[model samples]
Every structure is written in structure tokens, then in C-alpha cells.
Target: MGILDDAFLKSLWVFHLATGSCNNCDIEILDCLTPRHDIERFGMLLTGSIKHADVLLVTGAVNRQCIPRIKRLYEQMPQPRLVVAIGECALSRGVFIHSYNCPLPLDHVIPVDVYIPGCPPRPEAIIAGLVKLIDQRKAQTGQAKV
Candidate 1:
């Protein structure tokens, strides 16, 4: 019944950020947008600017160089925003954990609402994770399904 109810889940605009990825996770994100997955069908859209986004889809590890930029982007987004860290790299730095350039995981840089783990999680997994996040939002706003 509130403004943050199911209405909020009707359309979720997302902004994608790649800190220091190998492009594998990026490609999978593209796959989610393609006709095959068609995430837009669920009212999920990839926006050009973080200011217009409801969710921040971050791919790749958080490196020293990208820390400030990523934090800035997170700050630019409007309130009631969600951050979904996609990929093993974003989750725990994966193979780059020992890399000198890798400074922290995505959450360490900014708060992460959900995490999709994989070298590069499949499109299906990405969609599922997003849905879960939406559901979590619904619950938090007292719009949970019966």
C-alpha cells in the first residue's frame, strides 16, 4: 500500500560498472540484456547514468584505481538504490585476490545488497538474483507475497 510497495518493483533501472574485470562478466551482463534473456521484459533497463538508476550492477574486482570512481558513482544514484555485485571477482576478487592492483571486494568499497557469484554468472543466474533482490525490497516495504 506504500509507495515502496510492488510499484517500486514495476520498473528497475540499472547502471553497470566494471572496475577491473576481464570482460567475461561484462559479456554475461550483455547477455542478460539481449533478446535471449530480455531482462527488459521484467521492466529492468540498463541506464546510461547512475542518477536515473535504481540498481547498480557492478562487475569485476574493486581495484585501487577505481575505488574513488565507484564510490562516486554509488553516491550519484538516487535514494532507495540497490547494489548488486555480479561475479566472483566482485564478490571476493576471485583470481585477482592476490593481484597487487586489487584493493578490496565490491562491498568493501560500497554496500552490496545482493551478490551473484561465478567466474561469470550465467544470464539465468543474473536474472534470478535480480528477482531475489526485488523480492527482498518488497518484503522490506511490507509488500511481500502471501
Candidate 2:
């Protein structure tokens, strides 16, 4: 990594936004922080507010009611914010695809940086996807391999 890149690299503060989910993905997200996963060891943190986050982990299908809120939240995030579509629902609306209320996937609401796919992806899968996101960020900024 270059000097400029090294100066900026640090713990990533993540914010979780739930459109409307069964909470399966939410649970798995939490699992990532537990003893077994130890995601924090990699410098990822879950923050309660979007303003403080470098990354946003979006869960659930995009229901009509939540569309406006989603856009607002996306807009609220700081510049260079990354969005991760967490779970099958956020990726494709999952079981809610057939419902009239869930008209669009998360990407339609905001740009997705990385997608962690699974009905409720295991914590391990989520971690892998996050690593990819981090590497992508490095590449985007012209940094050497981490």
C-alpha cells in the first residue's frame, strides 16, 4: 500500500439497515462478531448510525413502503460509502419476490458494492464477501494487494 493509502486504512464502521426481513440475515450478521467469527479482528465494526459508517450492510427485500426510506438512508451515508447486499432477499427479493409489496431488489434502491448471497448466508460466507469488498476498495484507490 502507498503512504496515502496506509494513512487512510483503518477499522471499517458498518451500519445495518433492514428494509423488511425475517431477521435471519440479521442474526447471521451478528454471528460474524461472535467469538468464532471474530470479524472485529479484521477491523470491521457494526455501528448504530449510518453517518459514522464506511460500509452499509443492507438486509431484507425492498418493499414499496421502505423504498423512500432506503433512498434516504443511502443518501445519508458519507461519501465513498460501500453497500453490501446481505441475503437472498436483498439480492433478489427471495420469497417476497412474488409479493406485490416487494417490487424491487436492493440494487435498484442503491449501488451495491458486494453481494453476499444465501437465503441467510453463513457468517463465513459473509466474511469472505467482506474480504472481497475490502480488496476491491484497495484496487479502486490504486493500492497494492493487501
Candidate 3:
């Protein structure tokens, strides 16, 4: 594997973007970072900038006002990017599906690699989704084990 590929598999930097959530999903994201869950041990670090992120962990529904910003963020990420949609809000707008403010689901705004469905999915579920993404990445890069 090349240096970039090795680096990517070693440390997956993530950027969390909240379109318009109720904070439940956001809280679960934090829980993943806490010592109890400690996703960092797997080399998943939450980053503040999209430029440094390997994956985008997006929470909440795509509101009319947030659509452009969400698109901009997705555009800013580097190549080989993966977007993981968290919760029912991002998947199908949850209870806010009827809200006029939320015009579309996340996939409508940007491509999504994985989806974790729940009003607010558990931290374990979030980690599982990330692992799935990692496995997909490995396979795509021809690094998958036989």
C-alpha cells in the first residue's frame, strides 16, 4: 500500500455536521468519543475541519437553510471521502419529515456511503457503521483480507 493509503487506514479523521437536529443524535456522537466507547482506539478521530476529514458523519435532516452549507461542506472534503448518515432524521427526516423547512434527506444533498437508522442511534451502532465503512474502504482499495 502507498503512504496515503496506509495513513488512511491507520487514522480516519471525521467531521461531524449537524444540519438541523434535535441534539439526540449529536449527543450519541459525543458518547462515541467518550472513554466508555472510545472510538479513538480504532483511530477514528473527530476533526474540526472538513479538509482533514476522511469521513463525514452527518446528523439531522437537511433543512432549506442548511442545504447549501451542507453541500459546501461536502464539496470541501478531500477525495476518497465517505459520508455516514446518522439517525432517522438524516435518513428520512424522522418526525420532521412533514416540516416544510426540511426539504430533503441527506442523500439528496450529497452522496451517502452508510446509514445508521434510529431516532437517535446508539453509540455502538454508530461505531458499527464506521467499521462497515472502513471495511468497504479496504475492499475498494484492494486491501481486503481473503
- lDDT for residue 77 in candidate 3, whole number 0-100: 94
Pairs that collide in candidate 3 are none
Worst 10 residues of 1 by lDDT: 1-10
Q: Write the per-residue lDDT of candidate 1 for residues 1-146, one digit (tens) a residue.
A: 67655666899999999999999999999999999999999899999998889999999988999999998998888888899999999999999999999978888889999999998899999999999998888777777642
Candidate 1 — which residues are off by over 4 angstroms?
Answer: none
Q: Go through the candidates in order and give the clash count of each.
A: 0, 0, 0
Candidate with top TM-score is 1
Each prediction's whole-model lDDT (CA): 0.90, 0.88, 0.90
TM-score of 2: 0.93
Q: Candidates' TM-scores? A: 0.95, 0.93, 0.94
Q: Put down candidate 3 lDDT per residue, 70-132, tens digits, no spaces.
A: 988889999878899999999999899899899899998899999999889999999998888
lDDT for predicted candidate 3 compared with the true structure:
0.90
Task: Compute the lDDT of residue 5 as modeled in candidate 1.
Answer: 54
Q: Report the C-alpha lDDT of model 2 over 46-105, residue by residue, as the tens digit.
A: 999889888889999988999999899889998767889999999999888999999999
Q: In model 2, how large is the Cα lDDT of residue 37?
A: 95
Backbone clashes in model 1? 0
